[model samples]
Target chain A: MALLEIKNLHVCVGDKEILKGLTLTIEQGTVHAIMGPNGSGKSTLSNVIAGNPVYEVTEGEILFKGKNLLALKTDERANEGVFLGFQYPIEIPGVSYATFLKQALSCKRKYLGETPLDPVQFIKRLKIRAQALGVSDDMLKRSVNVGFSGGEKKRLETLQMAFLEPDFCILDEMDSGLDVDALRVVGQGVGIMREKCRSFMLITHYQRLLDYIEPDIVHIMINGKIVASGDKLLALRVEEKGYACYK
Target chain B: MAQKEIENIIDASYKYGFETDVETETAPKGLSEEVIRFISTEKKEPKWLLDFRLKAYNHWLSLKEPQWAKIKYPPIDYQSLYYYTVPKKKKNLKSLDEVDPEILKTYEKLGIPLQEQKALAGVVAVDAVFDSVSVATTYQKHLAEKGIIFCSMSEAVQNHPELIKKYLGSVVPYTDNFFACLNSAVFSDGSFVFIPKSVKCPMELSSYFRINARHSGQFERTLIIAEEGSYVSYLEGCTAPQRDENQLHAAVVEIVVLKNAEVKYSTVQNWYPGDKNGVGGIYNFVTKRGLCHDYAKLSWTQVETGSAITWKYPSCVLLGDHSVGEFYSVALTNNYQQADTGTKMLHLGKNTRSTIVSKGISAGYSNQTYRGLVKMSKNALNGRNFSRCDSLLIGNKCGAHTIPVLINENKTAQVEHEATTSRISEEQLFYCEQRGVNPEDAVSLIVNGFCKEVMQQLPMEFAIEAGKLIGISLEGSIG
Candidate 1:
């Protein structure tokens, strides 16, 4: 069974339709990349799947692990092992990164019927994961993503993904603001988390990110629909030919 | 988000709204010279104190209610309120166990168990004032052993008359403001603390005030004096039963800090905020100020989350050279409540400094405002002040406002003021929700972050309580 299945999804922000009849599916142990131009409904797809309240799911269905994902709220979808790496990470002024992650982890543990991690073990795990993502101790002490540079924000996102260890990860333009060195760190973080039971969907406008973390399948999205699908070559083709032909 | 869902999220009933049934005695309903005399005579106050009350009464009759605050309320009928009330007791209890079980239960329901064994464990000395009388005081003996005077205002008047007489209206004169004058005229029981020179207080001193008598106005006066080179931290908490008729609560708090002394005052006010339609609640108008002497420091931290209409400004008079003043506050108004609160920093001494941080959260149909003033005199050479007021709105119907007044009399003084009004961003909430935190907890996290600086200033126990109060106050405010 597919890890995530979207069937003829139609989404809108206000009265303006952003995702018109979009459909996609990701099976377990797969890395699927979606390449699209600006306003091509790529971000909208990720948001709808994440159950963002701002984007109304006007029609169709979203299924995760053979369950009706549309019937749940954002946090429920998250508890079901679905993750959306934000394009622009928010800066919460007073909530420390450690506190936010602890809360999120505790919620997931409660949902899984597992005992919550004690503070000592929690901090131990946090330090190891933060170190792997190249996130400094000072960064963890600061408020979540507050005053973080573009690279640091992306790294923090990677750290969160590593911490949550979601079954289905959605990387929405995760490579947008990262420098080459920082991009390598984020890519390595994602690579370390790949497992036979987990899957990922990488949404991007360029093929450079694919060179770091290879994709099993790549789809081209244009004007609110998937126009083409191929393997890694499709991303390379878009990088060379641009999105003009797809439009 | 469904309108019904938003209503459900915001319709959390007041948790501390249950009234305890007990026998009580109340003064005649109305304010007059007779009522002032009645209050003084009931407490058996000294002749000098009665004269002070009479003088304040005459002055109060001459002053009108100030209309400068950005709040709307029906005209207060001062003539209709019972000025004083007290629980009927056979005699004064020598210990906590002999106190009225009903009053003890009331405090327990409010999460403040007054049991000797269960008391905050010597870490805090509490003076619990129920209605208009001090019921039971804990850790008094321990505090007294350290040469610190911590007791109810009435007790201080009887036992420590000299100290009370010296500092009673010294920091905030009886003529300070309308509410202060009214409090002076008919004030009942409140906490009083005095730290001797060079003595750092052994533990945090606390006062928990409750208004229980129907139709009675709670007028409590608190005075704290820190002698030269001493230090003390004080905590105050208040709650009242839910009632349909608005009750009046006018309180006056004054603090005097002498040379090389430091005092920290914190208040968590969670009075009943009335029903969703705004039919009944407390009209809380208070005057709290502190005076700092040479090289002294004073800090005020308050978390206000209750009352139908709140109008108060905890201020500081930096009167001595190199003195410092700080005000950190987080005021939340939900349902149909309204709050107009902030602080005043008067920099009169050379090289004095002050810092103010105010955070206001408004939800439902409530309105919250931050009105503050920072003034530096011409002789305050190199005086400095920095103030930041931030407001967070939860719903479309709610409102938040920031009004700051800055007066720099000398070119050498530097003042920086910044104010911002914002709604909890959709992206921020979504980010948290997507991380498996529900919207309610998400809102709490973001709001706590918004009030991080102020919360840090609070003691550990009070910080935890304040954070929970912030969460409960904002319940159901988001979708």
Candidate 2:
């Protein structure tokens, strides 16, 4: 069975319907990218799948691990190994970045019925991982995403994905505001996680991020439905000819 | 002139003339001349103190309860409430079964033994009380070496009448306002601290350390004096939850910081709020103010989370050159609670500076208001004040208001005020929950973040656990 299965998913914000009858499936250890123009309900799919309260699922059956996924709360979905790397990650001042990631990881550990990590061991691991991702000790000590540059915010998001190790990774516009160097680092950071039997759902408009982390299949979503599905070549074709051809 | 007249008129024989005193545990329910006299007599207070009470009571008769705050409550029947109760309440403590179940429940929660709980609760008149003698003596002797006088108001009156007479009501006079006037007339319990010149108190004098410590109860009057070049930090209220039966609480706190002295007063008040429906809970009306001399600094840091209705303004009169005054507060209200709290900074000295940081959090059906005043007097050349007041609303039903009054009389003085009212955004909440934190923990995480500045002003342990206290205050507030 697939890790995540969305069938006839219809979502709405207020009285306006955003996602109209979207259906998709992702199996274990496979990477899939959803590419489309703006207003195509790309972000809505990620939010509804992550159980965001703002986006109401009018009709859908989202199954994770062969169980009803929509039945769980947002945190429950997180604890069950589903992670959403937001396009514009929220900035929460006065909460240390280190504390934020540690608490999130602890919650996942607790949900998995695992013992908490020792402070010394966790600090050592955090330092190593942070150094690899170019996150400074000062950044770790500072408030989470409060004053981070756009590149730094994406790096922190990648660092969080590294620690959380969700089974299904959804990166919504992960390459939106990245410099060339930051883009390479962030792309590689997500690329490294693709080896852990983790299914990836990369929602992007361009094929730039695909150069670093290749995807098995690419789905062109137009007006909330998968209009076309093909290999990585499809993303390159959309990037060159523009999304107008798909319409 | 009245003080001197009262002293001269208080005949020596009148002290012994008062009938040996009734054997009753409480005065009859009412406020009158007889009740004031009865309270003075029961406490064995000095004639001048009694006269002061009488003077305050006489003035109170002409004052009415202020209705300017943003809160609604039933009119209080002052005449129907008891003005005096024995410090050592005569509780029928034959067995634990006779105690209020709430008391026992709190005892169990605090892990206190039945006997110690009874003693702490002032239910019994135990002679061989909890052996705080050794502990108290240790700190008292240490403090005495530095010429520090730290004791209860009653003890201060007995041991150092001259000091009390000179400084009591000096900062906040008896006729300051309605509630302070009432507290002045019938205050039964409070703390008094006198830090001598050039001496620094070694410990954080907390009411929790005393074995015979009595809660300020409904009416508390406190006085603190920091002499020249001295330093001290005093902590009020207990960290643990307290079940107070009093529905109306009015307190007055006054502080005088002399030349080159600094004093930091921190209070963490957690009285037992009524049930979620707000059937019955304390109405905290407190007036706290400080006077700062040249180069003196006084800071009031308070974390108020209890009480159905809280009306308090801890202020400072910066009278000395280069003096500093700071107010850091975090007032959290939940479950039908209402709070109107802030601070006043009167910059009267040259080059004096004041900082005010207030964070108000409202959850459930609660409402909160941050009312502040920053006044720069005519002589306050180069005086500066910076105030940042922020309010966070948890649910849609709760409300938060910010009212700041800035009166600048001096052309050279500058006052800057900034305020922002924000509800916990769905994006912020969803971000936390998506990271695997539950709704309650998410709210607490966001709230603790919002109140970080004020919490940092608290003592180390209190600051560390402030997040948990805020969490507990907003329990059952979110889904």
Candidate 3:
């Protein structure tokens, strides 16, 4: 069974339609990349899957692990092992990164009918995962993403994905605004998280991210629909052809 | 915001609205010279005190209730309120055990145990004032050993008359405002603390005020004096029982910090905030101020989450050279509640400094406002003041306002003010939710973070409780 299945999804932001008749599926153990131009609905697809209320799913069916994902709230989808790496991470002024992650992890544990991690164990696991993502201990102590540079914010997002260990991860523009060194670090972080039980969907406008973590399948999205589908060669082709043919 | 979501936020009921079933004595329902005389006689106050009350009574009679605050309410019927009431058993109680069991249970229900054994250990000394009098004061003996005079205001009148006479109404004169004059005339009981020169208080001193008598107005007076080179930290918590009629609570708090002394005052006010339609609740109008002498410091931290209509400004006066003043506050108004609160920082001495941090959260149909004033006198060379006020609106129906006044009379004085009003963004909420936190908890986390600066100023023990109060006040604010 597919880890994530979207059938004829239609999403609208206010009166304007952003995602029109979009359909895709990702099986377990596969990393699928979606390449699209600006306003091509790549970010909208990730946001709709995360159940953001602003983007109304006018008509759609989202199935995750054979369950109706659209009927669930954002947090419920998260508890079911679905993650959306935000394109723009928010700056919550007073909430420390450590505190936020602990509460998030506790919520997931409660949903899974498992005992919550004690403070000692929680801190231990957080430090270990954050270190792997090259996140400084000082960053965790600071307000969540407040005053973080572009690279620091992306690294924090990857660190969160690593900590949650979600079964299906959606990286939305995760490679944007990152320097080459930072991009390599974030890519390697994602590369290390790949497992047989997990699936990933990388959404981006460029194919440079694919050079670090190669994709099993790449799809081209244009004008709110997937126009083409192929393997890794599709991303390379777009990088060279500049999406003029798809237009 | 959906109608259902707004309804849920409005239905977040008050948890500390249970009445104590205790027999009580109450004064006649009226305000007059006779009422003031009656109260003075009942407490066996000195002639000077009675004279002071009479002067304030005449002054109060000539003044009208101020209507300048950004809050609306039907005119308060001062004549219809019982000016004084006390539990009958309080006159004969010799110890905590001898006090009324129902009263003890009431405090326990409010998460404050009155019994010495079950109380919040030695870290805090509490003076629990119920209705019109202090019922039980814990850790008094321990505090007394440190030369820290902590007791009921009525007791201070009898035991430390000199100190009370010298500092009472000194910071906030009796004729400062209409409500302050009323409180001076009929004030019943509140905590009084005095730290002698060079003495550092060993534990946090606290006063818990509970308004229990029906139709009874609670007028409490608190006075704290930190002598030269002394230091103290004080906390105050207040709650009232639910009733169908609005209750009047007018209080006056004054603190004096002498040369090189320091004092920290914190208040967590969780009074009943009325019903969904704003039928009944407390009209909390208070005057709290402090004066800092040479090289002294004074800080005020308050978390206000209750009262149907609140009009209070806890202020500081930097009167001495190199003195410092700070005000940190988090005021939340939900349902039909209204709050107009902030602080005043006056720099009169050279090189004096002050800081103000105010955060307001408005939910449901409530309105929250931050009104502040920062003034630096001409002689205040190199004086500095920084003020920041932030407002967070939960639902679309509520309102948040910031009104700040800055007066810099000296060229060398530096004053900076920043204010921002924002709603909890959908993206921020979704980000938290997508991390597995529920919506309610997500709101709490973001709000707590928003008010972190003020919360950090609170003492460790009170900080925990204040955080919980913030969460409770914002319950159901999000759909």
The two-chain DockQ for each candidate, comma-separated, is: 0.73, 0.50, 0.71
Taking chain A by itself, what TM-score does each prediction score?
0.98, 0.96, 0.98
| Regions of model 3 farther than 4 Å from truth | B1-11
Where does model 2 exceed 4 Å of error?
A: B1-24, B87-138, B208-217, B238-246
**Which fraction of the native contacts appears in each prediction?**
0.86, 0.75, 0.84
Tens digit per residue, CA lDDT, model 1, B60-157:
99999999988888898899888888998877677877777999989888888677578777688788999998997788787888889998999999
Q: Write the residue-wise lDDT of candidate 3 on B44-116 in tens digits.
A: 9999999989998888889999988999998888889999999987465678888888888888888886677
Ranking by lDDT: 3, 1, 2
- Quote model 3's TM-score for chain B: 0.98
lDDT of 2 by residue, B95-184 (tens): 436544543343334333345434334221111111011111114545677788876677688899999999989998988999999999
Superposition error at B374 for model 2 (Å): 1.1
Compare candidates 1 and 3 on DockQ and give the better one. Answer: 1
Model 1, range A1-247, lDDT digits (tens) per residue?
6998999989999999988898898999999999999999999999889988878988989899999999998899999999999899888999999999998988888877899869899999999999988888889989998888888898899999998899999999999968899789878988999899899999998999998999999999998989999999889988998999987
> DockQ of candidate 1?
0.73
CAPRI rating of model 3: medium
